[model samples]
Each structure stands twice: as structure tokens, then as C-alpha cells.
Target: MPVHNSDIAEAFRRLADLLEIEGGNQYRVRAYRNAAATVEGLPHDAARMIEQGADLSELPGIGEDLAGKIETLIETGELPLLEEVEGRVPEGLAEITHVSGIGPKRAWKLYEELGIETIEALRKAAEAGEIRDIEGFGEKTEQNIIDALGRFEGGEKRLRLMDAEHIAEPLLDYVREIDGVKQAIIAGSYRRQKETVGDLDILVTAKRGSDVMDRFVKYDEVDEVVSKGETRSTVVLQSGFHVDLRVVAEVSYGAALFYFTGSKAHNIVVRKRAIDRGWKLNEYGLFEDNERIAGKTEEEVYEKLDLPFIPPLLRENRGEIEAAENGELPDLVQLDDIRGDLHCHTKWSDGKFTLREMAEAAKDKGYAFLGITDHSKSQTVAGGLSEDGLAKQIDEIDELNEELDGIRLLKGSEVDILENGKLDFSDNILAQLDYVICAIHGGFNLSREKQTERVLRAMDNKHFNILAHATGRLINERAPYEIDLDRIMTEAEDRGCFLELNAHPNRLDIDDARCKMARDMGLMVPIGTDAHSINGLETMRFGVAQAGRGWLEAKDVLNTRAPDELLKLMRR
Candidate 1:
């Protein structure tokens, strides 16, 4: 059982949750949480780093004490501290905290008052009308618990796209190394870049006697082999993630890849087109009567159908086929098209790096500019800066810019939108920065009408340049707060304010569907990483993938502009 970075991160996260539910020291709980984020964000495997004698303590937020624990876990495949905490705390209580509207404190309170320690027990209590009798809980809270439980169960069954990548990339590399293997790729929803994936579909082209399937099942992570055949196999990984692999001949490789990498709806429409043209299409090839006509490549198949190649990201049957026919397909935004990032944090707020370090990282990425949008005074938990603190940061940024070269830093603040629709900072304070990214950190339970109006009123301010994570959703963890996005987008367009496609994997807010809506309305969407550390900056690629799925071109993004042009656009 090899320990991957994700494994270490998950262990740390679980330990933190259990400790918090058991009333551990606040700083101790925070250390584990921060360590989890650091390990998870690393581009390379932590276990390998330890093998190479690298000092984990050198990583941001990972102290000498924490580094020792990581090495111990890597060497022994277990963390004694985590085991110790688990022995004292009901492990199920950690899982209960994951439910929407429930935190560690609330979970602990439930356990104390109702003797509920697991989701099932909590559900039973809620259904029996026992939860409302608790001091802080009432009928609405109890009902919300039942609704959130449904979502929690469904979300637990799927893996986030980022997590899937962590598992698939290593496996794909292992498969490609097998004797006689030719080409290998993980298809299905993973290839389409969906926010979540149910399972992985891998396609390969190999020589006649390739031992691909035989070796695939023996990979280091395989926990169970469900089935095995000459050219196909199924296995479940140690992480409980399922994977399927299929091998095909050279001629059918493209067709197999196309068939496996699909939105079912998109595949159905394409198959219909083939049927109407007196041709048959399947995993093997496209056949006309008894002769094969296309399928050596996806482009070849599309060409035979009188259409151009549709990128996998756009193969959702969402006007893509018609667009290809009318020659109106967009040149989707690529990672290279971005000139800068307009939403990031530094140590002034809940970030891991200093301004100079973050700027150097941006310069390394070839970015022309980087925006420093620290939290406003309202986000105290995140060490939000007061008005004077923000003023000092503005000065520090000016000083750093004068000394730095190639990367210009844009001073900005991620101000909070209050429950009554007022910006956290007044106009006097906001006008001092290069831009403002207003967001909602609390009040997620507001009515849809109020939520929409709260955002609409915030946009009325001249300083509101962008709405951060427009929906306040945390993917599987929390559903988006109720709001009429159609009305909000229209209001933003009228006000000349942009909406963010937050690139954080946990909150790919303003998801693909909304991205398309903004595109249709001719609104520019900035792909902000909402990065908290230098490693966090790498999430820009995910945003680009989402943007491509939404049919956006380089011109449809705000940060694609050069520094001067971007500054001009920022001014209302």
C-alpha cells in the first residue's frame, strides 16, 4: 500500500475533524487543517520527497513538529497521533460535520444533547422530531437536516475531478509502461473535465500480444479486481475509486476513445446522425453499409459527418454540433491565453505567502500581473484586514512593485457583502485599491429574493468590480445558497461588473452552465484562482477547462488582457 499525497492529506483532515469534535486546542486543530491543505496542494508526492531526503518542514505552514509526523506516517503507513485521537472520539462524529449547516461545534452539541454520533443516528433523531426539542435547533433546522442528508449521501458516492486526477495520472503512467502498450488515456467524464466523476474509463491501443490488462490489475493501488478478460478489466483502488480499462487495435483506437469519452446525450445525437446518413457508428468504427468509412481519428469521424472536430470539453450536445455545422464554433480559451490572475490572497489575509513571494511565483508562471485581494475586515476568522491594515498593505504592495520586475501587483480587497446589501468597506476605503471583489461569507440562508437583491445592491457601488464565487457553494459539502442567478447576471451586465469563475477545485462556483449563460449575455468572466498559496495558483488550468466547456474564447475573459488593458477595464 503506497501512501500518496492525497492519502496523507485525508488522514490529516480526518484527524483534524475528530480532534475538533472532541474539543481539542484551537491552534492544534488549525495546524492539522492547514497541513492538510499544504499536502494536498503539492504538485509532487510527499512520500517521494521524504524518500529523497527532502525536508517537509521547508514547506509553507508545515513546521518541524508537523514534518516529523508526516515522515512517520510515510515510513510506517499510519499516524499514531491520528489513531490516538480516533480512539477517544467517535469517528462518525467527524463525518457528521461534513453535512451542510453543521460544523464541528454543532456536531459536538448534537452528540452531547441527543447522544447522536453518526449520520444515520442523526437522521433517525430528526425524523422522530427529537431534534427540535434541543435548545438551538427547531423545526426548520430539523427539516433542513433531512434535506441536507439526501445531498450528502449522493455527493459521497462521486469523486471530485481534482481527486480523480490525483489517482488516474499515476495509474495511467503505470499502464503506459507495460510491455507492448502503445497509447493510453483516461476517457469518460474525466476527459470532458466535469466538476465530478462517477468512475473512470481508460482506453488504450496496443500490439496483439500486449499484457496491459494482466499488469493493470497488479498495480500498487489496486484493492480489488472485479473482473479480468483478454482486453478489458475492472478494479477498485485502495481509495475506493472504481476504474475500467479497455484495449483495442490501432484502427479502432480513436472510435473507442470517442465512444468511451462521452456525455450519453451527446453520443445519442451523434449516433442518430450516423443512422440518418446510412452509416453505423460504434466503438470500432463508422461503417457505410458493409464498408468502414471513418473512425481512424475523432476528427476523421466528424469530417465524414460534415462537421469539424468538437473538443471533448464541448461535446455536451449543447449547440456544439450546430455551431460546428454553421462554422461558428469558438476558439475556446486556453491556459496560455491568460495574462494574469485577478483574485489571490497573501499573508495579510488567510494566505500562506508574502507579497514578494506570490509575485515571484506569478512571474514564474509568465503572468504579467497578479491581484492581491485579501479579505476585508468582516472575515475575522480569515484574519481580514481592517481599513488601516489594508492601507498599510497597499503601501507595501507599492514598495514591492517598485523593486520587482516583470510582474505588477494590483492592490485589491475581497470585501464582504453584508446581509443588508452594503459593501464591507465604504467608498473612501475601496477607492484606494486597484479593484474590488465583493463576496458573501455569511448569511447563506437568506431568501432567494433577498440574496439576489443583496448582490444587486452591492454591484451598484462604483467600486464593485467583480462578484467572487457568485453562488457560495462548496460542491459536495454545501449546496449553493438560494438566489436567482439570471437576475443577478442581468444586473451585473447593466452595471459593467464582471463575475468570477472561481478556479478553486472545491468551489468551481459560477459553474459551466452559468459560464455559458454569461457568455450568451455577452459578459466577460474572469477566471480567478482565489489562490491562498503559490501552489493554489496552479488551479488556473481547471478554470480554463471550465471556460472551454462554456464556449468562451480568450476575448471573453478579463485577465486575458495585457496589464495596461486590464487596468483600463478595471476602472468603472
Candidate 2:
């Protein structure tokens, strides 16, 4: 099996986590973490780059030593350094970090101080009243840990939707190569564009002579074949993602796709609708009196049900069926409708690229504007810019905008919203920029009332124009800090400020439901890549997918407007 970029990135990340746990040199551990981020966000496969004799070290953060490890991992599916560290570190020590409230330092402390290495041991200690005795942990923290462990226990490992796409897209491409395959699409939550996916369901239509099932189980990435039949098969891929494939006749293709691409609740509604119309709907076709009425296409299937074809992303039974019936379905935002990206970083902060390079990349993608919202000084680890440093960077953006054509660079800062609801930079400094993207960099542990007040107070700042990643979530990694988003949305509406749908795969904050809430509240939610590197701009697709699921139309997004109009809107 080919070693994917995700594999190499995971190896580097593990090495970093283990090194951090051991209190290794900060720079060395940071280098590994940085390399992991750089490799994971690459637009092309790192393994393919190595195979083409391209220099891996040319990529950002990849020094010669790290490059060699990446090459070794890709070539042999193992990293020697990682293996050596795994031997020294208790393997389960890493697993402990998966619990919500227990970071690496805490995990290491639990292991050394309490002899609690595995989650089982940690749970026992927490339950036994021993965990609260630790220097920093209290009864609250101990209970939180126990609650987190309870959540983790018996949980099925799931991948972020984009990660599933990483495996699914390539697998679908391979399946399409079968001689008789006519159509193939991976369905289920993946098709619905959920933020995370449990597994994949692939539906295919092929000619009578196809051997697609055999081809599927024989794919190079298949770790094991769970089951197989002439028309259906289940296999676990090397990445531990389970995939099921079913081939249907051309006449039944649409019905199978609709059945398998369901949120079970949504399917139930559709089936009830079919029954109301004296029709039977199943994987085979939509039938009346045992005679097929429609099945050849999804459009036909919905047409028979007296509804227009619903986009897969909006088929969550969340008022979509009702909306379709009432002719109130939204025209969800599209990738092409995006006119600019308003939140991104550069080497001025923690980004890998320079201002001009980022501008050029956005321009290449047909964007009219790109906002340089690099981190402000409170985010020390990202090397946030001081006020003086931000002034100089703003001047550079001014120069770049003049020299560049077809794209405008907006001067901005991702200023931290401090604990007391103060902006990181002075109002005078913040007002000089095109806009301000205030965010929470620290103090994620505030009370629900305090957190909401902090954000609302920040929004009240005269310079505040957008809230970057409003929820501060890292998907499965960290839960959103306790804040009343309903209150935040109301405040944003009153204040004329917008919210961001941070497009980074790991931080698709202001989730689909919130996005829908923003739309209903008449808030302008722009999709920003928050790109640290040029390649990060490609993450816009995920954000667009997320927005579609949220039922956002082009008009609901601020950046969908032309540059001039967007500037005016942001100022509102």
C-alpha cells in the first residue's frame, strides 16, 4: 500500500507528542509539530512528490532530518525515530490525551504522579478520589476527566469529513477505472457533508459484465475483507475506515443512492411521504401498485414524491423536506460564489507564506480580495505581532496592494479578545486597519456567562468587524468554550459585525447548525480559509460544504460580494 501523506503526518505528530511528554527540547518538538502541519496541508501527495525526485525539504518546516524521516515512512511504512520513542513511552500514555480536559502535560503527570497510564487506570483513580489530590486538579477537574473518559469509552473512532474524503476520493477514482463502471459516489454522512463521518457507503452503477466488487476488495489499501458478494462488499482500509460498496442496476441506481445516502430520520420522512402518496419507496425503485414509477435518477425519485431534487447536503430532514414542499429551500452557497477570503495569516505571524505569495495564490483561484489577518501579540506561540510590528506589516500590505493587480490585500489583525473583553491591540491601532478579526486565544475556561460577556464586550469594540472561529473548537479535539452563541449572534446583529466560518479542516468553527442560526438571524457569515500557508486556501471547499449543510445562500455570505461591496458590508 502506498504511504499516504496522512500517514507521514500522523507519524510526525506522534513523535512530537511523545517528545513533548518527555520534556524534550522545545524547538525540536515544535519542529516536528510544524512539519506535521506542513505535510498534512500539502495540496499534493508528499509521497508522490518524493517519488518524482522532488526535494521534500523544500516544503516549509521540513528540515533535512525531518525530510529523511518522512521519506523513510513513505518508503517503508515505518519511522525509526517514532519506533524508538514508542518503545520508551508507554503506548497507552498517548491514548490518555484523547480524553477532553487531559492534555499531554496532564497525561504525563497522571502517569508519573499517580501511576495512571491507561484510561482504565485514570478512571479508577478519578473514581477512587485520588486524582483530585494532584497539584492542579480539583474535584471539578476530576469529575470532568471522568465524564470525558465516559464519553471516550466504547466510542467508535471516526475521521473528520475531509480526512474521509482523502481516502474516499482516491478509492472512488480507483473504482471508476473498472471497465464497466458507469457511476460511483460515496454516500452516507460523507455525501451529506457532515463535519465528521463514521464510515463510507459507496453506490455504483455498472454494466452487466462488471467485476467491480472483486476490484474493490483487491484494492491496494484494503487491510481486510469483511464480507463479499457478487454485487456488494465490505472492507476495512489501511486507515481503519470501513467502506461498503454496492453495485445496482442502471434502473435502480437512483433509488439505491437515495436509500444509502440517508440520514435515517430523513429517509423515514421520505418513506412516509411516499406512503402518503400511495407509493412505495425502497432501494429498488419508487413503485405504485407494484409497478416501478421512477428510479433512474434522483430527480425522478423526488419528482415522484412531488418535491424537487434536494441537494444531498440539505437532506438532513431539518426542515428541508418542508422547505422543499413550501418552495422555501435555500440556494445554498457555492464555491464559485465566493469572491474573497477574509481571514488568513502570513510569515508576519505564524504563516508559512509571505503577503505577496498568499495574494497571488488567492488571485490565481479567481478571488477579488484576500485579508491578511495575522495573529496579534497575545498569541505568543504563533509569534503574534506587536503593535509596532503590525504597523509595519500594514504598510507592507499597502505596498503590495499597489504593486499587485487583480487582487487587493486587506490589512487586518486576528486580535485576541482578552479575558475582560478588551481587544489585544489599542483601539487607535485597530481602527487603522481595513478590519479587525477579534478572537479568543487563551482563557478558554471562563464560565458560560463570563465567556459570552467577554465575546459580546469584544463585539462592542468599535474596531471589531468579524469574529474569527467564533466557537474556538478543534472539531473532535476540543469542545467549544462555554458561550451563549444565541447571545453572540444577537450581539453581532445589533453591532453590525460579522462572524467567520473558519475553513481550516481542524477548526471548522461556527458549525453547520450555528451557520444556519446566523443565516436566520440575518448575520453575514463569510467563509475564511484562515490559511497559514498558500495550500491552506484549498480548504475553502470544506467550508463551502459546511455552509451548504448549514443552508447558507450566497447572499448570506459577506465575501460572496464583490471586493468593493464586501468592504462596504464589513464596515456596516
Candidate 3:
């Protein structure tokens, strides 16, 4: 019996293979693949859809012949064609084909000649000479298999966001072509803009899937096309991310997307909680032992779980689960809730925009004020401003404030916290401005204990009002230096220092989990776009989404306060 989530698709795929193995008509073999996608995408269980008399012919490729076969599967418990296919094709071939570099032709050759089946067996054979002996197999193929094994090394592994996107776009585009497709989107970490993404999961809604299976295989971008079915299909993007496109009816699109775009841990916690109350949770709709309960969209998914629908950015094994279960998810934060930006560079140091241009951009963004934090004297690589440069920038800012219509600009520095717990700019240089956002630009080799201490001491500098990019993590480029987030959050909170939620997509640092924890600790969180240019200001929306994931409300944000109020907090 098919048991996996992707089973229905797998079943039809097998039928297609059996057609070839039995030397059946090519069109006849294609029917099984077509029917599989239709079955997979009905928005309800395939067995249930069949029992309710939903016509498989609604799918484009499925006609009387294949529809009858699918009806038999639900009614009789077996397919004559499936049995023949199983007999002729080795059971292990489907899984073997799942590996990145392997295909049915290679899988067939391995099974027929070398008797290779499971991924492990194939790995072993490839490592040895079993695969090399195949007609087309060579060292290159062997190396590719080895690389594939490494790619799939960890359980439910993760990938870079760029890698995940490369796979998702093509599949999402194809999903819209399914007979019933009405809307489509990519959800989960990929949507959340997480740096390291797992497999690409897409959300889709369709009205007719009878034609779905046939259309998916026809997508121009799909490569090494392995299997096609009525409701769904697994295709390898040229980029090597395995995308499984799911088809569901328009009514259930929202719920299905919620289920598929999950942090598995988040879903498990919600599902178990539902089961505790005699409700079943799944992609289609929440059920009370097979009775329709709630589900039409993502909101329903959370409502059924007895919590508000959380956004994609907030689903990572963060505190959202606990917050939701407790009926205490923070009030949703909106993009407009942010009133000021605390981390920005000006051409006075590393930024491209002049002080007036930066202030004008902030006004355009409707911000009450903007913090112009240029590099301090120590970071000369950024053309760091020396004392005289700081004085000149301050004079320029004061003149701009006098002449400018609205947005007020504050002079500050992204000052380096030197190795020995000292700031790059002196008190004279710091006090001449409105605020300071001290940061760690280097010295990552210090012990976690010393690094934490160095930052805490910097926080004590009365002139330094914000801790910018606290972890100094740069997504795929840099690892978060070994500092204790718990300790860092505590110190920042105790001292009333603003914690930066850097909005650089590469550094959504102090991510939602830490962000939630910071909220729990009653720490002040400032959502900063850390814009290097005008285009970067848009990144604040991502930070707002992240804040929502942490269950933070407008009141919970530091910059949400009026400029006068914010200044009071920074001064204190």
C-alpha cells in the first residue's frame, strides 16, 4: 500500500513504468502517469474522492481507460496493471530514481543487470564497480552519485535559499497549468527569506486536475523528468532541487499550502494538539475522524489549531508554536508599525546616498526619523570618518534638519567595539551626535565568554543607544560567532539597549526564535532595514514579517515609539 505523503504520485508513476516493463502501448503507459497526478491533486484523499464520485476524467489526460483503473484501486484494492508493473520492475527502482543523478533508464539497467535497488545498494554498487559496468556508466556518473549521496546526507536536510528558489519557480509555474489551478505561491522558509532553506514547497489551488499530470511533465524547465501523474509529479529542476508539485481544489488551497510549507516540528506540535481534542490535521482540511471540520485557507489551518494563522517567516521551530498553543501569539505587527531606522550608512562613511538624499528617502518611506550611522575611525576600509569628518557630518545634518521639510536626520556611527571593550570613537566624538549604534565589525576569535563581555561593556557606553547586528552573522557567508544569545538578550534588555533585527536578507539575524525569546525577556527590538542604499529600505517589510512571527505587537517594538519617545529611551 502507498503510505508516504508523495505516495499517490508514486503509485501512478509506477503504473507508467509497468507499462514500459510489460511492453504495453506507449500511450497506455502515459495514461497511468497522467491519472496519477489527477489522483494526487483532488484536494481530498484519492480514495475518498473516488468514493464521492469525483470524476477522474476532470483531469485532462485521464480518460475512461485510466479512470476505470483508478476507480478499481479504490473499490477493489488492487490494479491488474500495477501488479504486472511491480512484477516486471523491481520495487527498489522508484527510490533509486529519487537520487539526483539517477534516472529510470539507469535504474532499469541497474536492476536488470546488477540487481541494484535501494539507495544504499546503489551507493555501494557505484562505489564498487556495479554501476561502472553499465553501458553508459562511467567515473563521472559515479562521482555524480557520490555527490548526490552527500546532498541527501542529513535527515530532512536544509539548503541555501537561492538553491531552493531555483527549484521552486519552475514547479510553481507548472502547478498553475494543472486543470483546476486557480492560485499558486511558494511558502515556508523560502517565502520567509530564510538564508538556509530546506526542500522547496509550493502552494497551489486548481479546479480540474484530470489534465494536471500531462501538463506538468510538459513544462519547459523540468529536467530528467522521472514521473508524472494526475494530481502531482516529481521533477528535477536543472538546479537539482527535487520539486513535488501538489494539486488541490481551490477550496482547500490555503490549508494545503499551510501543511506543505511547514517547519515539520511546527506541524507536528499543532497536529498532536489537534489529535488530543479528537481532531485530525492534514493538508486538505482539519477533520474530526473524517468529518469536515475547518479549512479553506491558511487562517483556517491556524484557527483549527486554536491559534491565529502565523506567517511563513514565523514557522521555524520558533516560539510561535508555544505562543499559539497558549492563545497568546503577539498581536500581528504591520509594515507601517516601524517609525525609524537605526542602522544606515551615509556616503560620509560607507553609504552611497548623501545626507540629504538619505533623509529624503526616509521621508518618502514615511519614517519619522533616520539614523545616519557611518563607520567609526577604526573601520578605515569603509572610509571611516575621523573626528573632523564626524564634526563635518554633524554640521551637515544640522543644516539639513533646518532646511528639510519633514524627516529629521540623526547623526550616529556604526562604531567598532575594539578588542578590549572600547569604542572606536571617543566620547567627544559620540556626544556631538544624537545617538550611536555600536557594532562588532571584527575580532571574532574571542571566546564566547569574552565576546559576550566585550559587547555588554560596549552597551554600558551611555552614548551607544543600539546594538547593531548583534551576532555579526552574514548568512551563507559568515557563521554567527559563538556568543550566547540568552546572555546577549539579557544584557541588552537590562541596559535598555535596542537590539537590531538586521533586515539584510542574508542576515535576518536575531531570527524569529531569538526575537520571540527577546520579547519574552522584555527586551526592546528595533526592526532595521540596515539599508546600504535606497533600494534596501524595502527590506523592512521582511523584518516586520519576522517580528510578527515572533508574536510581537507594535507596542513591543522600540522604533514604534514616537521619535521624541524613542529619543528618551535612547538617552536613558
Per-residue CA lDDT of model 2 for 200-262, tens digit only, reads 899998888788988999999999999999888999999988899999989999999999999
How accurate locally is residue 450 in candidate 3, as Cα lDDT from 0 to 100?
Answer: 90
Distance from true location, Cα of 65 in model 1, Å: 2.1
Estimated TM-score for each candidate:
0.96, 0.96, 0.67
Count of clashing pairs, candidate 2 = 0
Tell me how far the alpha carbon of residue 367 in candidate 3 is from the true structure, in angstroms, after superposition: 1.8
RMSD (Cα, Å) for all candidates, in order, is 1.7, 1.9, 17.7
Local distance difference test, per candidate? 0.89, 0.88, 0.71
Candidate 2 overall Cα lDDT vs. reference? Answer: 0.88
For model 1, what is the C-alpha lDDT against the true structure? 0.89
Winning model by lDDT: 1
TM-score of 3: 0.67
Tens digit of lDDT per residue, candidate 1, span 17-51?
A: 99888888988988898999889877668877887
The order by descending TM-score is 1, 2, 3
Candidate 3 wrong stretches, greater than 4 Å: 1-180, 191-195, 209-223, 301-326
lDDT for 545 in candidate 1 is: 93
